[model samples]
Target: MQKFNVTPLLVMLGALGLTACGSSEQEEAPQSTKFSLGVSDAPVTEAAAVVVCFSGIQLVGNDQPPQSFTLGQDSSAADTNDLCRDAAGNVIPNTRGIDLLQLQGAASEALISNAEVAPGNYGQLRLDIAQGSYLQRLDGSRHPVQVPSNQLRLNGPTLSAGGTFSYTLEFDLRKALVDPVGIPGYFVKPTGLRLVDNSEIGHLEGLVAESFLINNQCNVNPADERAAVAAVYIYEGLDLPIAELADNGGTNTHQPYASTAVFFNNDATEYQYAIGYVDAGNYTVAISCDTTDDPENPDEVNFIVTKNITIEARQEPHQLDF
Candidate 1:
């Protein structure tokens, strides 16, 4: 097994396109006017913008696509990228989601109800993931999730009658037809770090690392093997990637950083709350552990924590979280 002897570690952390007819900016005139754009998620890292395309336009950013806005990446924004970010604590750029058409309306109308809207010739977008009456009327067809909204087809210059206006879209990103996989409630094991090495990158201590499927809060049960089926990811810190660790071999990112992970103990229970293998030194340690229901009801949940943690054996295949 791998071990961390020293060094402080931290960390934790995609999209599609649409088509359009316009080739370039219109020559009608460069209308000089200050405009503002808003999406459900802003520059958690990247600057948020409304990308206008041929067939339709939608907002995207902070690692989530249009349909994924309602979805939570992690139980705690401090722990995970809110579930939007990958194991690394960085915010994935493409996660921004698109609004459904049912909620579409003029910025002028929504401003009255919204405090974020600034008074002006606004171009607001509200989407409903559902197959609403307005969506059918606007596109004149039933659009698959892959299809972009028709609003993008509308020329930006002609969008507002007034020269100055603000836009806001409150469309639903969740599919009303299917059950949500993750709800608002969830917890972690040895969250963030597990205090492994005190030197640089702590030498591997050879601790056993095990994984389990738990409810909203991370804890294992003897009779309940059902939760163990959920996928779980192991990490050193919310900010560090696994591929960079010592044994991991530095292949996690564009330019791999030195990274590694190890089993916590002889028994699989070590992976449960154990922070991987901590080096023999003084340091802060952390880990990210999560799972979701196969057919998530997005309703009730609970937490489980024990002193001597051991899992029940079962014939069913165990699932791994990516």
Candidate 2:
């Protein structure tokens, strides 16, 4: 019965206006520049699978218009079953969603590979995660995960000619997959989405000691439930106020730059958390157990802990053990 809180939270191309130097032939058609749009995620500890049905992915450039690339129709990685429908209950192609769970622990899966487009100073990337986006439990039951507006427009990054720009769409599953009070199923708000340039951001990784995991007081767990790290909160500054650590959107001013839940590795002997595509800067990391115990009241400080560290450009995963 833990009420987890996350209070925090690419493109482009070129033209058919071909490049020709008055040559005999059209310079091999300008080679149709490619843009590789990838999909990745921060960790989500609560579910076995966070499956999102991405209908399409597009890139908008400063000079070039928005161009959409075909989704996972050819990849064996995609689930092409008719899980979606139109307003009139007609079935539509389920071409582009990725099981973000499969991309956990800073792993990335390509949504579009060498997608041919007019390359220019691309400013935005659009993702359509329409109806049929859902989650699967460890027990195998499925529940619809609501995506507000169903369209995500990520603004940042630029693509250029003959350059393969790699962009990773990160889904903060802990923050996105939220279970409201008295709500039957989890409702996913779009607030947890991030579009990061993989080449520019740093990575953060660490392990939560067994002592902290042993102290978890979350209301639900199975008999074999061993130690697990619940969530990690990363704030922009190193001097974040202690009060802000518990402030999960209760205050308009306090918010995290990025946040995600922690999960155990395949062996399950130790619990680890990882965050990818983090910008280089100083950040205050807060770790918390998924507990229903109210932090509004005193005596629950152990449920959450904070650490301050600095990350550098293109740095390998920075370690912060707790």
- The candidate that wins on lDDT is 2
Which regions in candidate 1 have their CA more than 4 angstroms from the true location?
A: 1-54, 58-123, 127-300, 304-322
Q: How do all models score by TM-score?
A: 0.19, 0.72
lDDT tens per residue, model 1, 1-322: 9997543332210011111223233444344432233322110001112111111222223133431122123121111122122235454332333332212111111211111212222222322221111111122332222223322211121222224433332211111112223532111111111211112121212222234333333443323321221122223233343334221112223221111221122245443211212222222222222232111133121112111111122212122221
| Collision count of model 1 | 89
lDDT of 1 at 306: 14
TM-score of the candidate numbered 1? 0.19
lDDT of 1 at 184: 24
Q: Tell me how far the alpha carbon of residue 289 in candidate 1 is from the true structure, in angstroms, after superposition.
A: 8.6
Tell me the tens digit of each residue's lDDT in model 2 across 143-254: 7776667777767466666776667778766555676667666666556777777777788888776666666653223332422347677889887775655433433244
lDDT of each: 0.23, 0.64
